[model samples]
Target chain A: MARVIRTIGWTLIVLGVVVLLYVVYLLWFTGFETQREQRDLADEWSLTVPDDPIDHDREVDREAPEEDDEPVDVGDAYAALWFERDGEPIVSDDVIYVVEGVDLPTLRRGPGHYPESDRPGGEGNFAIAGHRTTYGAPFWSLDVLEPGDTIHVIDRQGREWVYAYVEQRIVQPTELWVVGEDPLGSGAPMITLTTCHPRYSDAQRLIAWGELLDDPIESTAEGGERDEIPES
Target chain B: MADNDAPNGDDPGPRADPDGGGRGGIPRWVKAILLLVVIAVAVVVLFTTVFPWVEERTQDPTMGTMLTPWLAYLRF
Candidate 1:
């Protein structure tokens, strides 16, 4: 009967509409949740890391947060990451807070630090994972970064660790070795950033590796101009 | 039976009220269309606003993450 046909047609239309709206939610609306969380994390970072710069003489004897390094809670924000090209910031006009874990909930908040890896500015590998296409897509421009670009990580004490981009690789999600010890076999303090490969899909992972520069630029307590931190 | 079909050769179904609609109210088709529209709007609002708002607090596994395996299967 026409009524039966009409009912089926209406059901299909409703289902189609839901599917379309969900796609929109995935791509667009989800970012709102991330942005709000990022804001809260930024505020928390400022409160925890004071604006006052460390005294140079006292700082020389003090290492980059490793001496008193404590275990970070899984979902806690620990550091801020920003990108630069030839010393000019490439993206992240607002620094992206790196959460402590790569689990689903933690990553939905921001770039997540692999708990197995060393903390930012520590020895060995400091690995992080981020969403590239949704939840604010903090690493959306990961592919655009070229070797020799810079990634600056500001730790809890406001000390800036500058890393020079070394290489980028696209690998299967199962390639756990990419974040393992000395992934590049360089035997240096390195950083790894991972995100789902092929924008809008997660069939693979895009990894970018960076090595810490010889010296880290310490942010002055003033902390007003984060980018102006002179290379020490 | 032939009288059930209008001059345009279409059946509007039996009219209980005999005023072209049931109980002298909106046509059944119009009501059905309205219901569909309401459902579509609710779905859109739930996905866009209500769900995202709740997700910010609940931190539950997101639909995107849960559907990844299915999406990969569909693509392959």
Candidate 2:
């Protein structure tokens, strides 16, 4: 009887050990490691902006030649503003805004903003949200982006607007100021990218803010020249 | 006493039955119950622990190559 009891105890101990090992393997070597690796790679490519130039304005608005006004190609416009990582396309169907005087669209779970808010390409903050972990993790590397990395927002009219990153902040889920109606003051054009924080949970949101660096630049024109319109 | 002594005099003392009074062994129902318990435990371990861990690893962009299907699922 004693021998049988000993055998049962030994079996339970072995089972426990096996379970523990499996848990450790999954935690350390599986999805967690993958997330870390992707972020690390992204960090290598992110360019940091210098603090000394914070007050300096490098905005530009070059007027395009009136004669070259043939309808701009939307495909070219998309290509001009698109960003790629590891040869995988990161841009989605959603459009980001970079033009002044445009109102930000309403925040929603899916594609396109609320109808009452600004329409895509119309301008304000053409904000978009994506999952940081699931859904192919499109914005998983967004945190790796640093100040000065270019964000391009192209319109269907073949007008491409360029933005330079200014700052990034991790905000609580309840903080709506990151997407405030008066982001950067009234009529200040900006582009905001948001994603789930910590790259694992949706408990918080991470935001990256940028200001328009130049006026709408048409892709059809030679050498990517900016189009000038009267300032609002 | 005379009838009991003569027929089994050559036989040894009363022997114990190897089959325990002809009673059957553990029932099939008991075996089935044990199997179900094992399966339940395995499922609990998988969903509560294993699944989350796998998800975390796949979320990592660096290890994304190891989970091609997981990455593909991210597209809308």
Q: Each model's fnat?
A: 0.05, 0.05
Task: Please state the interface RMSD for every predicted structure, separated by commas.
Answer: 7.8, 14.6
* DockQ-derived CAPRI band for the predicted complex in model 2: incorrect
> Per-residue lDDT for B1-76 in model 2, tens only?
3222335457522432243211354444564466567656866786688765664443322210233555445522
Candidate 2 residue-wise lDDT at A116 = 26
Question: How do the residues A132-174 of candidate 1 rate in per-residue lDDT, one tens digit apiece?
Answer: 8788988888876665577888777777777777778776565
CA shift of B30, model 1, Å: 14
Give lDDT: candidate 1, residue B45: 83
What does candidate 2 score on TM?
0.41
Per-residue error at B72 for model 2, in Å?
30
Tens digit per residue, CA lDDT, model 2, A1-232: 5534754675577567767776566434444443443343223213221222111122332243434333322211111133323322234322222212211111111112212223233346655454465533446567555433556644333345566555666755545555655466747566666666666654456676666655522322122332321111
TM-score of every candidate: 0.72, 0.41
